[model samples]
Target: MAEICCQEAKSPPATVATASASAAAAAAAVASSVMDRRRRRLEMKRFRLATDLEESAAEYARAGKRQRLQRTASGSPPCPGAAAPAEAETVDPDRCPRYGVSSVCGRRREMEDAVSVRPDFLTGSSSSRSHFFGVFDGHGCSHVATTCQDLMHEAVAEEHEKAAAAAGSGDEEIPWKEVMERSFARLDERAASWATSRSSEEPACRCEQKMPSRCDHVGSTAVVAVVSPTHLVVGNAGDSRAVLSRAGAPVALSVDHKPDRPDELERIQAAGGRVIYWDGARVLGVLAMSRAIGDGYLKPFVTAEPEVTVTERSDADECLILASDGLWDVVTNEMACDVVRACFRSNGPPEPASGEGTSSSGKAVSRAESDKACSDAAMLLAKLALARRSADNVSVVVVDLRRGL
Candidate 1:
């Protein structure tokens, strides 16, 4: 009887162990199955996201191609939202044709920043077009900047034409560097004449009427960009800047001419001028920038010579941004480019084809949308400067350089 009891108890223990092992194995298998399912779900999510991105990019490309074909076939006018090319100049559809500008006084008592946009400013024999964009920031008064807005493009066009004619053939590349330098020199001379003869010239602004002497000290920073199908030429004379967004990267087209720059400092010192740090580095504790148009009182130290950079256009070129110190002081080049890129991406579809199933207001609707995108980009940058507490006048120009797509 004792032996039988012991055997029975051992049998029960064996059975219990077997059941425990089976349960553990089953639990582990269940857990492994759940993990496998989760992994598959994650992979599926990744695949879907990748597919969506690819589809979106392909759609964008297709849309661009279709729109180009429509425009070519219809021979329609440019989007009404864009600045009209010069009446005498022929518009090249392949060139950069869209741009936006925004300017504001921005926490300052006087508005001194000026922006100029002239599309198709120059036309070559091969029918290539060059668009001109400029941003001028005046220190003592607005007249110098206003003058730049009114006259810089004309001077650039004149100089460019002379250079082209001298080349004898449009097939030959024009020397953009020399052309820009001559144009800037001429502009500076004119500005100097304006300042000296302020009394003879009719009063155009508050400075001339109430503060006539201020005209003598007045100076303006000039940052000009000439965009052609093959090249981009930038001329900078002061603290204002020009930046190109190529492949989503910010490429500074012109370096700011600040008094504290090493080379600028050396040049000023060589000219027997001192750089004083009052508020910021200043030429003789007066002008914040080392070079500018006008400021004849500062003479040899504050030159009108511009630093010109000519960059060959590339497939990756996205857009060009020109802005005064008010925007640069508060916004970084990368940040500005990002904002503009977003604006471009968010732009709606192109205008409907005229002959196809298009409505009467289809072109108008599309034009407004396209125009709003660029203008919004410029306005957004200026507003951001204000939000960041920039103390100077704000001006921004966003030029769309995306070609063919």
Candidate 2:
């Protein structure tokens, strides 16, 4: 530095000026490089922030969709302005009374239970509508249950339509047993078709992926109830059940198809199948239920023929319940009825209208309260089952049948 200064002093003023200018230019270049680096870092940070926000939004949307699906699957009423589930038929709320549904995985590894509710599914010539509610418990897969949820009601509706056409009028006293039998037969055929067809898109479950050839072993228990103004028709192909609360008394609408039952055992033996006691009198040491929708390998033994029951409705009827074995295993029919009754009582009644006739607004208020009570009852039952240590999926559907407040 001293040598340069001495040389500059002896050389010329122009030399000193030139050196200073070069030094200033170098400092400017360094400063510009630093600014460029800072600018690049800021842009990268902004990009990351935008990506994170988009991801968060997408996750939120997915969560909301899942919640909606769960609500629909559990038979809970949809929120105002929300779209109805694709599997359920559109319902006219005025014609359809309030109903509630609750379903949970409980302690199961995978959820295999499904519920379907289609209010006003079948309309008669006189504008009378029959509501449909069903419960399906799948074994070895969830596809079967989901399939039943999607197709069972439609199949039943088609059969009803056919019967109505043949009888020349939907208002005529149609044979419900024949109609239900035909519908179940058709549903079984469709289930078989669905299992065999590999051309269709894959399911979201691990059953098919784990064992492609195990489709024949998959099956589901179906308990369906068609509720009209005058009657209640219940059909059962397996252990799921339907019960009615009439004037606060419990009524078993459908019997469970257990393998150990005398009639079921006789039928299985007649079909050349044995009910071995592996995990509770399973047919051929495999399926616990004597009858089911699928199980092609055990078709002759595990029939799809549902036992149908028709009951005349009465003004004293309070509510109707349909549930999978998970609820029935731990809770008795009477207890279930009691729970629902208590819920109804807890909610009390809507205020009476001033006039003798019920105003439209008064009816709406009553319906809303009834719906809430039903929801509470169904949820409580499911929770009760869980608290009792149920090891399977729990599903419950509560249909409010009260005529007036």
Candidate 3:
């Protein structure tokens, strides 16, 4: 260090010595301050590291506690509820038809998608633990979708109840596919009635969804799957679809109803409506879908009658997927099945089984990990669709068929 301060001195040596000592002292002080600041910054970083570790541990503990405590009545699963979860939904592997659902708002400004799962959709003497899973994609408004999410199951249950009552004498059998179609028809009529009943001048919903009575045809597309002990019945309207993952392959269960389809176009024309080419094919250049719920303005042209398909469950079936068009617009059935199968595999190498005598090539998925697999698969599909630039909201449901999830 070179000294800058020098006091009046008789000799040059003494003056030089004083200046050297003063400069050294100043340099030492500056160095000490710099060292102190660096030390404090390092300490702060360590403190933050500790804080973050503590928070993470606490969250993990809380999650474990919630899993242990959260339960529903016997034979039923719990809802994700108000926590909004922000995480994948899980169910105890002990439950039947191990299924989980997930929905995401993609490039759209708002999330207009709805999903639901009813473990014990119907309960009684027949004792069929039929499960219900559905995805509703809203267009122009989310109200109708939300409404269907809340009421569609009840309509189905009503029909099932009637069938069960009639079969009490053991003379009749409950036909699920027919019930599904009837339920869809009832759902459409219910929505139409509910919409027309609303005040003509009522205010729009929080999402700015128009009242069904006054809108340009606000409606929702629906795809539903009913998991009975013997059958997997699917019903769909609009473009939402359902696919069954079988032996690691994709088997489409419901066909997407598009305006461009021959039958759909013919129906529209028969109803005295035009199928015009606008932003692709559309009915009267208005609704892009040929069938939907609560499109009162386009009624007689756009119907809510869903096409139902029934497939008997077999050991070969792996899982089921019900998703909105937002997913189908970019993702394919094979791709979705592959993603879900991968998720199940990543969960823990599938449920371990002993002995090589069995010919089941694919490992069985455990009920405990099944929920995570389904939820993850759904979320992954939605994210994949978004990454592929899907322009609408996305929703997905995965039901583990083997070992009853």
For candidate 1, give the lDDT of residue 222.
97
* Per-candidate clash tally: 0, 0, 3
- In terms of lDDT, model 2 sits at 0.80
lDDT of each: 0.80, 0.80, 0.74
Query: Model 3: per-residue lDDT, tens digit, 42-138?
Result: 8887667556543543454455344434321244433444222122222333245656677888778888899988887776555456788999998
- For model 1, residues 160-267, the per-residue Cα lDDT tens digits are 888888887652378888887898888888877877777577777776787665466778999999887788889999999999999989999988888999999999
Worst 10 residues of 1 by lDDT: 352-361
TM-score of 2: 0.72
Candidate 3: residue pairs that collide: 93-367, 98-404, 98-405
Q: Stretches of candidate 1 above 4 Å error?
A: 1-96, 123-126, 199-204, 209-214, 348-365
Instruction: Go through the candidates in order and give the C-alpha RMSD of each one to the true structure.
Output: 16.1, 17.3, 15.1
Q: Answer with 2 or 3, whichever has the higher TM-score.
A: 2
Model 2: per-residue Cα lDDT over 246-287, one tens digit each: 987999999999999999999999989999999688999999
Clashing pairs in 2: none
Residue-level lDDT for 123 in candidate 3: 60
- How many residue pairs of model 1 clash at the backbone? 0
